[model samples]
Target: MVEETIKLAYGEYSDLIKDKRIAAVQALSGTGACRLFADFQKRFSPNSHIYIPVPTWSNHHNIWRDANVPQRTFHYYHPDTKDLDFASLMDDVKFSQNAPKGSFFLLHACAHNPTGVDPTEEQWKEMSYQFKVKGHFAFFDMAYQWFASGDPEKDVKSIGIFLEDGHLIGCS
Candidate 1:
C-alpha cells in the first residue's frame, strides 16, 4: 500500500521512487500522517519552526502544537477580493526576515480548506522558484488530491512542479 501510494502521489515513473529515495510509512489518515511528520520534525529539527498558511485546516494547529513544534502563519487569503493574496503570500514565503532559510511549510496541495482557494499553475511555479531561492521545505497535505480537478494527475500539478524543480517535498 505504501509503495502504491508513493506511485500515486509522486508519479509512477518518478526517479525518486526508482532510486529508492523516498521514506514512507502507513498512517490512518491525513491527520495521522501530519502528526507523524510533525513529531519527526520536532525530533529531528528541534530548533526549526513550521510556517503554516493563515486560515488552513483548523486541526493543523492542534497537530503541530501537540507535537511541541513552534508555529508561524503566512498570508494566504485576501478577504477584500475573496481571492488569493498572491503578492503577500509570496513576500511571506520569500522575504520573511523572521523565518530562517530552510524552514518547513505546510501547504494544501489542492482544494485548500476554509477558503477553497488554490493557486494557479503559474503561481505554483513561481512559488516553487521562490521556495528554491529561500531553501524552504514544502510539506503538502494532499487529502483532497482528486477534489479540485477530479483527476489525481491534474490535482497534483503543484506537487509535480516542486518535484520537477528538484525539491525533496513531504506529502500526506
Candidate 2:
C-alpha cells in the first residue's frame, strides 16, 4: 500500500544488511531509550557507574540518577575549541584512575545534541582502541542518526568502527 520505489529501496537495503552481533530494543524516544538502558545497567551491574559526556542531554543525568546509579562525568566538549576535547577525554578514560574498569560510558553516536560536535573517524578509532584497552562498554544514543550528515550510512561509520574494534555496544 506504500510507494513502490520506497519499498524497492527498502528491500535492497535490507538485503545488503548482514547480521552483526548487535542487540537492540524499541523505545518511543531518546528519553525512553536512555531510561531503558539505565534500568538495565542498574539491574545487572548495580555496582557500576555510568560515565556521561560533559554536555549531553539533560535527561541523561536524570535517567541514571532515577535508576539509582551513580554518575561520573568525562571531558567531551571543549568550550574554547567548540569541538571534541579528545586528549582530555582520553586522559579521563586512561589516567583518571577513578573510573572502575569495565564501566559503562554513554556515547552520542552522531550529531551530539546542544553542541552538534562529533569526533573524527580517526578519533573514533583511537577512542575505540582506548576503550578496548580500558575494558569500557560503549552505550550509544543514536537519536539523530542521519540528522547530522543527511546520510544515515555515513552516520553509522562511528558505530561500525566501534564494532570493528570488537566493542560490545548497546544501542537503541
Top-lDDT candidate index: 1
lDDT of 2 by residue, 1-172 (tens): 2233222212233422334233444576778878999899999998999999999988898888999999999999999988899888988778647566798899998899879999999999998998898899998888787788998777777877886787777765
User: lDDT (0-100) at residue 115 of candidate 1?
Assistant: 91
Which candidate comes out best when scored by TM-score? Answer: 1
lDDT of 2 at 139: 89
Assess the local accuracy of residue 111 in candidate 1 as a C-alpha lDDT between 0 and 100.
98
lDDT of 1: 0.92
Q: What tens-digit string does per-residue lDDT give for candidate 1 at 1-172? A: 9989988898844888889989989998999999999998999889989999989999999999999999999999998999999999998988769567899999999999989999999999999999999999999999898899999999999999998898988888
Q: What C-alpha lDDT do the candidate models reach, one value each?
A: 0.92, 0.79
